[model samples]
Target: MRRELKPLQLADCAPLGTEVTDTDPRMIYHGEMIPVMTPDVAQGIKDARRTLRTNRFRPTGKRMSMIIDGCAGKTTLLLQIGRAYQGLLETERRPDSVWTPVVHINVPPRRESNMDWSLPFADFFGMDHTINIEKRNYRSTDMTEPVVHHMKESGTSLILIDGVDRIHDSELTTAFDYFDCLQDRLRLSIIYCGRGATDIVSEGLHHRRRGERLRTSQQFRSSLPVMEIKPIPFREGAVEEWRSVLKAYDENLVLYHHEPGSLLDFETLLHERTGGYMDTLDQLICQTAQQAIEDGTETITEEGLNDMVVGRQDAEDDWA
Candidate 1:
């Protein structure tokens, strides 16, 4: 009864109350959400924003390109940047003088291939790709052309497109055309994210010779100043420091009563399992909390953390 508060109570008790339940995994997991910040992740955002300000943050300028490799926390950082930009645009509202951020798009790919070269922006902006069977006089061009007109009228700064790896090679070539066009057309910042396309980039556009493709695109790699997000720095006795993180959530959630070995097992388990991705670490902590609840225990146990690693049924997508 005490844990289940009224709907209004949740709002009224803001900053004052927290719901505690024996079975709710959120009790510990929500409170103890950890952020793994490295120089790469932290500095990239600073540098990206600096680049945006310097590049005039408009699509008319040279399209800013950032190629982040796998597991470098690219997606997470991009979303953070989007939110930060949203806040800035919301504040700097000079309807005619300034442009504002509007939408964020994450497109993987469609089932059928070979979309029109221009459909990258239009298809995402709600143009019907399916052909008209009943002589419906439906034209995709008409649908897309208005969006360009709308952008010219409205104050839209950018349309962020994330996860470009899913686009097929043919589709990607078509996308390049759209990017080239959008740069000339509107104030749209098209940000694309993918892991395995650096080679394609090296081969297609800029390489001087056939074998020199990889070496030539070293310019792209070397050009960006090597921003890599790394794991949280841990000292020799870092397990003790990790325990303090748990204690911050709830004193009862700690292991070994504030001793050195308090969180050694968890630290080792997570470091081995996920290499310290913040999302994986948060999931691990939540899974442990659920185990503790089911076991009717107060302290997070070594077995509980291990169970989280082992019980990842969706091994490919989950922490694995």
Candidate 2:
């Protein structure tokens, strides 16, 4: 139930110097490593970009979301999409004008009113959302006017909100109302990223603001498209994707002795080691690479991978 990105050739890195110098090229290359464009990240960005592009001028723009369970790289995927979209907007933006086309914020842990929801956006632009009515007393200001003003002024068209899953059922009413108000006024495209996004959005359909009718789940789905990122399954046909992900990382690595596509040799082993979870796989690869660099091995070995344990620690009883 996912779209595949067009295959891309991995960028080639210069070979590290054999001369023993004071600076280690291994460490240097490690710091310069870029985020791997895994299948989820690539496809998510593609779909999100298309949605954002199509919704650019709509009076009521469409919504999109990326949901990933656990630490399967939802934040990474969201940030990449935001950066890619922002890069697209930058080319058309006036060189002298200071405008933010993308706004990224995290859903707050605590939510009481619409003001609470607005706080994160205000904090992002460093706007003050509090008013001092008296010498010692202050009250939260309704930042709708200022927030909308700055958004419109800055030409902000897309908002990337992380952690939508944290919103309590009680807070959904105000939270959605605030979002609805923004859509009605600004027609901005929004991307929600979180573990519980699907359930949250489905549940949100049941909670409607006073005097407002709520849309069916089907209608919401038509408007707000959803994408999910889960652990890659190492089964028939699906195993190839797992290897492709590893291949992407391996090609980007700068290890001197690591043969291109050598990682594919351990495809099944790597999946078994990390259970095909992106975060664990990433940690395993990165930590293993760093260890190899420190140990002067300069290459990843199956034995080295066998020794690493990352991600949610299992219970002592389950330990191998």
Candidate 3:
């Protein structure tokens, strides 16, 4: 039997964040993420896990890259994949055992040196650099060694590097080299999330080695598969899909119909306005809901949408 949807209270409209809590149905249901997993994203996750499992037998693995524009929910998707993998580990574990199946790190912006790239990895593993280095006189690489060991011990196979576009051009080689080191030593599959395919492709081309530099240059291009996350198109039944998402939050909510002289459907109009971007669509829905609340109505009217659009323009103008 299908369960009836519940209406959302004001508190249920909180701004969405990257992290998702399994226990909060409101957060999970009404979040920016619409629970519509794209085939490419799903296959990417599967490939990462497969590579990890394959490494257990033969130790040869490959890496994946996701090139998505800003505000396209790349971080949200990565977090979801990481959390889902962690959940899987929890199900197959003893109560006292620890499992760390995924390690997600946001590459620091404008990193100019090798150590800068390595520090995040060391920090993620909670390695005490002061004690390991000052007292034990350990090298910088020594701090990162434990990460590899822990990953191997904890059954961790996927390392997600976010903000790959943030690495400066001058330090691109250094960053890629560091990733190569990790791949070779830990036998882990990696997923690098960047802003655009052009940046990644150009960098990969620029670093290609013809002679001595050729070895390191081809490292990224030779094995890594790059995938781009495109916007969800508004096609047949798209309105129904979006309506279902809205209903999850507010069962009483209704989409306002066009009054007259409207050439497009609401879903098509939304897609055209927002370029079918998930984050923009989310913001529009939230803002429309807020407007509905202010007007003491459960429906989002055309007037409310126009106000929201104008308000967005005003905000942009202010920034400008």
Candidate 4:
């Protein structure tokens, strides 16, 4: 909030440029200059939204899963998809109405009951989960009816459940059973996200309805197509892929002394440092940019990058 309140004094700070006076210096740190839109991310959003479009009004809405390893920006991709879907929803809905077409909630960790699963939706809608008894005494409210009522009233069509892997093995059956029933009740497409969301969802499908089988193995995996966001490989055929991403970052940088292709020049070094993981790569560049700004260099350099250690890969390399 402090960052938003105090805008960068670009008018007085000549080196920072007048074009970016409205933007804060923290933009470099947050990398908000350019959206997190990689090729795979773009395609994933396209495919997931396509599934939502086709299945949203069906009896039992179809689902999708995203399987991206840690540090590869799975959450970023999910949020981007939500933003895109919300944008689409806005055009189709009443201008004055308050309708949430895309709802995102992190699947609760260590979930133990159906009520526990409903909390995410309640939290999303800002509905209180506790009912007041006498004199400030409170008890948990059954959120099912309110949650469903609000979802229907708001015209929610898509749900994004992030961190499916966090649902404990013991809790999968209970957690997904509620999700399955919710999807059926709302007739909305759900995109489950995590590192191994496919396996987790598959396990849930098998155990859906407390071991009472409703679908076969082929039907289970087929209904929810998985999208992958693996790290960009720095190999002979894919070096340009890494360079292109860096080039996008370079073009969007707000540094005073930044050369057009300065980041692209360090392509190989960055690939080695971040192991092509988007989250790690984002951290490395943002931190390096912050250091450059503090030192008044206003440009990224090999020396600045060398002083910082980011990601588990870099730490392991340091230990070795």
- Clash counts per candidate, in order, are 0, 0, 2, 0
lDDT at residue 229 of model 1 (Cα atoms)? 48
For this target, which candidate reaches the highest lDDT against the unseen true structure? 4
Order the numbered candidates by TM-score, best leading. Answer: 4, 2, 3, 1
Sorted by lDDT (best first), the order is 4, 2, 3, 1
Q: Which stretches of candidate 2 lie over 4 Å from their true place?
A: 1-32, 59-71, 95-97, 130-141, 205-223, 312-319
lDDT by residue for model 2 over 1-320, one digit each (tens)? Answer: 01223322223433444443324545555543557777777788888878777777555434443343344689888888888887777678653444878888999876787777888888888887677766655777767778898999988777888888788767787787787678667767777778767656555645743234445454543235676687778898677678778888888776767788887888887877777788788788877776676666778898888777776544552665
| Off by more than 4 A, model 3 | 1-71, 94-97, 128-142, 197-206, 209-222, 235-265, 309-320
After superposition, the stretches of candidate 4 with alpha carbons farther than 4 Å from their true spots are 1-33, 56-71, 94-97, 208-223
Give the alpha carbon lDDT tens digit for every residue of 124-210 in model 4: 888888876565866666698889999998887778888887877788788778888887787777778887776777778667432
Worst 10 residues of 1 by lDDT: 1-10
Give the clashing residue pairs of candidate 1, or none. Answer: none
Candidate 4 at 284: error in angstroms? 0.5
* 20 Cα displacement, candidate 4 (Å): 15
Better of 2 and 4 by lDDT: 4
Best candidate (score: TM-score): 4
For residues 12-127, could you state the per-residue lDDT of candidate 3 as single tens digits? 55344323243344433333323445444565567555544454466344433333334476765666556665665557774234456677788875466666676787787776
lDDT of each: 0.50, 0.70, 0.55, 0.72
